[model samples]
Target: MDSEKRNQNYNTYVEAKVPKTKFWQALLKAFVVGGLICCVGQLFYDLYAYWFPTLSEAQLGSAMLSTIIAITAILTGLGIFDWIGAFAGAGSVIPITGFANSIVSPSMEFKKEGIIFGICVKMFSIAGPVIVCGVVGSVLAGLIYLII
Candidate 1:
């Protein structure tokens, strides 16, 4: 009787728990969200290339970079990119420009707190460690390889 009650309790407990996140759902979200971003980027790339056909491949690449930056800035300014970022965490943030949004959004939040410590300093809090550790590790690895 006790075992039967415990089993019933266990089943009820398990049922009450939140369902685990499925890979397919995440994958689908990533695909749809990320692809939408890439599609827009592709359209802009085509537009820029069409508008400036005389530019060399390197120049075109630079122009693409600038155009993407402009688009991201506009999206960030309009408060849409962050919403997209919230929905598509890795999907949105994997792009180079997403990092720009990540950095800028913090700065925007801290704008009222003054420039040095509030805006500039707080802005890089997330990015700072990534940059610092990356550079330091790269330098250390290079030094070790060079010595060996």
Candidate 2:
């Protein structure tokens, strides 16, 4: 029952087996993943254009972003999006949908723990700095371009 005795029963000498990683596996994952994500966006774009015949191409693109964000957030709320996320992996993580997923996923997960500390902290865990740095980087790049 002692701590030392409990520790002695642990499998300390067990070897860790690494899964076979291959370049082709990764390349295939990226191709299928990236294509699927883009394909879904395309489908949504087409649907929006079909439903709203008056929308311009630019307007359709904006609507697609809004629709993706809304659907991703709703799915996050219902816990269905995570399943799609698991299969899609990087596939579901390249567009505004990914942004919505990133934000909504953490908030939903953390909400079970508590509101303030759990939800708020985890909400900005990954995407916040990315968003911040992206804006700052764009501004810097724009300035440099203007200067030269």
Candidate 3:
């Protein structure tokens, strides 16, 4: 067969083997899962507020975020977060838990390489850009605010 015909045939075969996605179903799952994660964060915030009545709102928020991140890291280490991510897709990915997972997952995977070169280095492989962008963006925003 000629190269053009052979390429067309291969493309057809690949298309036939690909599974069809249920777009709406995936959207619904993502929405529900994301909402549930947010609700859990809110629950933590409420509990913290109740327990530490003298704490400021910012302090309560920090505690809640820390709790969520810690829980997400533990779950990722245990392999449960992978299942949740597979089911919820972007739902589980758009939250702070996803950031926690991004950091912990790589560190866990590279644990065999030792602390310095493996776990510590790889720990921020995925989240490093995110942290950088966030810091840079905040700085720019602060500068803009000051200028105005």
Candidate 4:
């Protein structure tokens, strides 16, 4: 048999072995999990506002964001966040906690190679593109606003 024919047969066999995904089941799981995360954030926001009444609205917002980021980093370090991400799919990635997880996961992964090169370098590998895009997108938005 020709090499091309053998490759084609192998590809067909692999395709047959792949499992089918249920769209509705995944969608429901993602919705529930993501909603739960958001609910937790809302709780934190309320708690902070109640506990520190003197804080301005901006301060409370920052506090809530920091709290969520810290919790997500701790979860990522303990290896629980990945499971959440797996179940939540894009739902998990849409939140601020997801950004925290993205940074911490790589840092933990490369910690074994030493802090300077491994942790620091790999830590930003995933987040660098996101930061760049955020800055570029904001600049473009600002330019458009000025033009209008």
Best by TM-score: 4
C-alpha lDDT of all candidate models, in order: 0.80, 0.80, 0.96, 0.91
Regions more than 4 Å wrong, model 1: 1-19, 133-148
Query: Across residues 1-148, which tens digit of lDDT does each residue of candidate 3 receive?
Result: 9999999999999999999899999999999999999999999999999999999999999999999999999999899999999999999989998999999999999999999999999999999999999999999999999999
Off by over 4 Å in 2: 1-17, 112-116
TM-score of each: 0.72, 0.72, 0.84, 0.85
- Model 2 scores a TM of 0.72
lDDT (10s digit) by residue, model 4, range 117-145: 99988998888899999999999999999
Off by over 4 Å in 4: 1-19
| Candidate 1: residue 96 lDDT (0-100) | 64
lDDT winner between 2 and 3, please give it.
3
Which pairs of residues clash in candidate 1, taking residues 3 or more apart in a chain or in different chains?
none
